[model samples]
Target: MTTPLGGAPLTSLEQDPAMAGGDADSGDAGDLGPQPVVNRTIGRRHGHHGRNWMGHGRRAKSNPELRGGFDGLNFHDQRYANGGNQFSVEPPDQGLCVGNGFVMESVNDVLAVYDKSGNELVGPVDLNTFYGYPAAINRSTGAYGPSITDPSCYYDSDTRRWFQVVLTLDRVGTTSSLAGTNHLDIAVSQTANPTGAWNIYHLPVQNNGTQGTPDHGCDGGFCLGDYPHIGADNNAIFLTTNEFALFGSGFYGAQIYAISKKALVHGAASPNVVLFNGGDPNIPAPAFTVWPATSPDGQFAGARGGTEYLLSSDAVFYDSGTSNTLWLWSVSNTRAIDKAPTALNLDVSPLTVQDYAVPTSLVQQKPGDTPLRDCFALTGCAPTYLGYPNIVYPTPRPMAVNDSRMQQVTYANGKLWGTLDTDVLLADGTHGSGINYFVINPHSGGLFANGTLALPDANLTYGAAAVTRSGRGVIAFTVVGPDNYPSAGYASFDAKIGAGDVHIAAAGAGPWDGFTGIPYLAGNRPRWGDYGAAATDGDRIWTASEYIAQTCTLTDYLTAPMFQCGGTRGALGNWATRISKFEL
Candidate 1:
């Protein structure tokens, strides 16, 4: 998959084409271009007292609005990958001290980084690097404006390291997937300082063409996609990808791949892609399951490992007939993905099969198909309700049979947080708007629908909910639109705790004080488009999006109170400009 360069690559951005206007070496953002200004006003009153996007649902909110800035944090954007396009930051500790953590991102190439701050006196730093094959581009549109997808980040305090995972999409023309051209790339790096020398490692995948096929059919929807995840457990890292193809261009089928973290992080330079048989760690026979020709969409979360469990979200699919009903298979194992002895030993099974209004599926699908089983779906109009847009994390519980959206379950602040995109049909009898959230009591099953926080605003809605391991609060990013055209605009928002309100080991810790700072927005696009996806490491938030020329580029970045969350009034920067540090 490696594309050979014609000559020694241009040593710096100064010499690369498509590199201009902004200074490549200096982090100084240039003059604001011709862009419109939209006034944004955030206040405590706007917060509905922890209520979710919908007033009464599953997830619960303590304090909706948080504070303005965190002290001592830095944001960095790495330029080594596709046009220095990805961004990450090393977050500060609880008391404004530089933290020993780092995160990195990229397109098509695996983006990973490592930093040490609190554990050792090493300088708090941010580092990022990429190792993967480049995309084959169109002579006209230029890789068809290929952008990064499903980007994720992580921190390992024990190893004093940070890791990033991203899917580099490849396309031959303006629309659709490119066969065999798209593959996974993993890059690992070590950070000793915020800016200095670093080591790099690259791993390319070797596929058997059996377990992972870009093509499959579910509910008439053909095998359509892949979202891969990397997790740490038992002192080792694991990698895996979800297999789902669109049947009839609508529904999805399910399948999964679990790679050994030991092989990726500690094994030989070349590692082969491995499949999960079930839950057994002793059997070596390869018998991973493929989506039966009838499942809907297949989705997978990053791998998670611990002394007790190996967890992942296997596939999130909708039944073909109606949009109201949806299903999720939360795959779990007692042993880590790398240690699973046999395919059958892996314990791959669905614990819960949830049901929601058909319209609710519209949240993730946005302006696409509205099936009958969908909870948000109404008779003759658009379906409402939306759920998590990024990736989902798994916990010790096996709720696949009772859960339809695995991305809703997350580990943060040392506790478990769940979000549900509740579909509520208005009394008027027309299918429309609804609620989405984090901080729900999943133990009550989907019946206890409550979110930790809620959006009272009439225009904006929430979905993808992420929480840091601490669980004090979870970060919820917004996806703004159903208007369809990119001209209407879409923005991302974040809410964190206020310094005056934070009280550890006390009840006040969970209440939403309403973010003190102005809500952050992904800069508006000159053309119509949407935010890519979001990820986090407790203290800071990150997201990605694809660009089309003067329109946009799929880019990711870190947003914390300390970083001040750019894209506010007087801020005319692209997502790439707000970065304070660079990893790779």
Candidate 2:
């Protein structure tokens, strides 16, 4: 277990602390110098031919297999098995951003855009192709590119540009293996239109200075920037990631980068990029998944040359099991990043909030008819099940509900709102997956509200919230357990009242029967999505989450060509994504 820097809350974090510089340009202790980067867009994305998984490739992760005939449980009343903009993918790393009447949704490796009336505008394009690399699975040839995953996006209304970011571990020189060097690939729309041209920028975050990046002295060869997310204030956009060893040991903590929005909007040849000293530098211990918050359009912080706030939890970071200390971070003076050494600063303060701990349960799924297992047992699935003739998946498998890290966050109503997965003791004394949320006023270093959000017998994972300028918001999550089967659900909340009941937006069709949880592949450790993404478009809150959209019997699955169960899924996995919207 890794221990964090501080344990107690810092008393009196008032604005204008009378440090060396003013509040915006205070240049506090342990502040690192900013690095610069150059970039250009390869070209406009080709056509919208979103060639999905064809159940090919041995090591391919997202070969979805549609489920079927479970223990007779129906999640929703939607006419079709799948719902609106519903599609197949494994471990839906949801990415959603709404702006200028356009909606964009990006999952594990695919992306698409639609109008307010649900008219398809742009993609369903693979991330690789969009990033100017070969698709994850080349449609014509069975070739692949470096792995790309964990995507996050936001529409910076201030600039009328949409920004999308993902992490890619470069393949070892054309071979289908990791090169131990990774980068944060970001694409910015040239205009407010989603179907228009875009510019792509790469930040070589291996931190070993291999790809023109700064050397942070990584433990292994280089570092992998996992779970990349983006947010913005009025003047600049910020990206954060969890640094881990690309090929070996070390979890180097979260890395942050601040870029000038003005420079990016104009497609500058070289833009000023501020790379902060992360966990490896021993600066105030280590900050884990310090998520940057997105504010409603035109509601950015105007004081101190525009301040962007981020929130993180050190509870699970120290592995002390539970904690109440929440780290509140602010980036000041982003307006002048175009000038050298212009006070692009980071300030961290630990605020004592509600206690939150990791979930005590394994996030179990509903009892279902194990068709994959049934076939492996009845017909002795040979090479199909990794050539193992002795593999048997149980009736009701358990889904992995990993650690309690901060999930989704937003800055609205002059406060910071965020939540993460945790454990809660119910009336029956049984521990269940729960949520701990906090609404903080960063200037004064105080929380306006914080509480637990949960249901009686279900588990909620990857909960995300989006708020309007008036404080009206929605919380989206994946609800599953002995009774629910990983359905897309949500709740309503505001500045005064906390979250309401967990409402199901789109019901799950079956259990999460992905390859990662198979005993032969991994050790029954079910692979789950990192986070759900929600954004505010005008007065509406747009959200997306992972769910099971289709199910089929073993006979239907085997009879279907290439295991594309009636166009519901692929071969090795059956995860689906559901996009939703709420009126604020």
Top-scoring candidate (TM-score): 2
Q: Root-mean-square deviation of each candidate, in angstroms?
A: 16.6, 15.3
Question: Model-by-model lDDT, in order?
Answer: 0.26, 0.66
Over all chains combined, what TM-score does candidate 2 have?
0.82
Off by over 4 Å in 2: 1-89, 138-142, 280-282, 377-379, 382-386, 426-429
Q: How many clashing residue pairs, candidate 2?
A: 9
The alpha-carbon deviation from the true structure for residue 498 of candidate 2, after best TM-score superposition, in angstroms, is 1.1
Q: Which parts of model 1 are misplaced by more than 4 Å?
A: 1-129, 132-148, 169-181, 191-225, 235-252, 271-273, 277-344, 348-355, 358-408, 412-415, 425-462, 468-470, 479-584
Assess candidate 1 and give its TM-score to the true structure.
Answer: 0.46
Per-residue CA lDDT of model 1 for 1-584, tens digit only, reads 11112212211111112111211110112223311111111011111112122322222233223222111112222222234332221110011112344333332222322332212222222222232333222333433333344444444443444445544434445443433233444543354232333333332221323334323323232232344454444334444444332212222222344444445445346444344422234432111222110000111222333321222222222232112222222334424444453432233322232323212222111132111111112332111111112211111101000112223233342223333333333333322223333232222223222222222221112233333343333323222222211111112222233111211111111101010110111111111111122344335433222210011111111122111123211011211211112110
How many angstroms is residue 45 displaced in model 2 relative to the true structure, after the best TM-score fit?
44
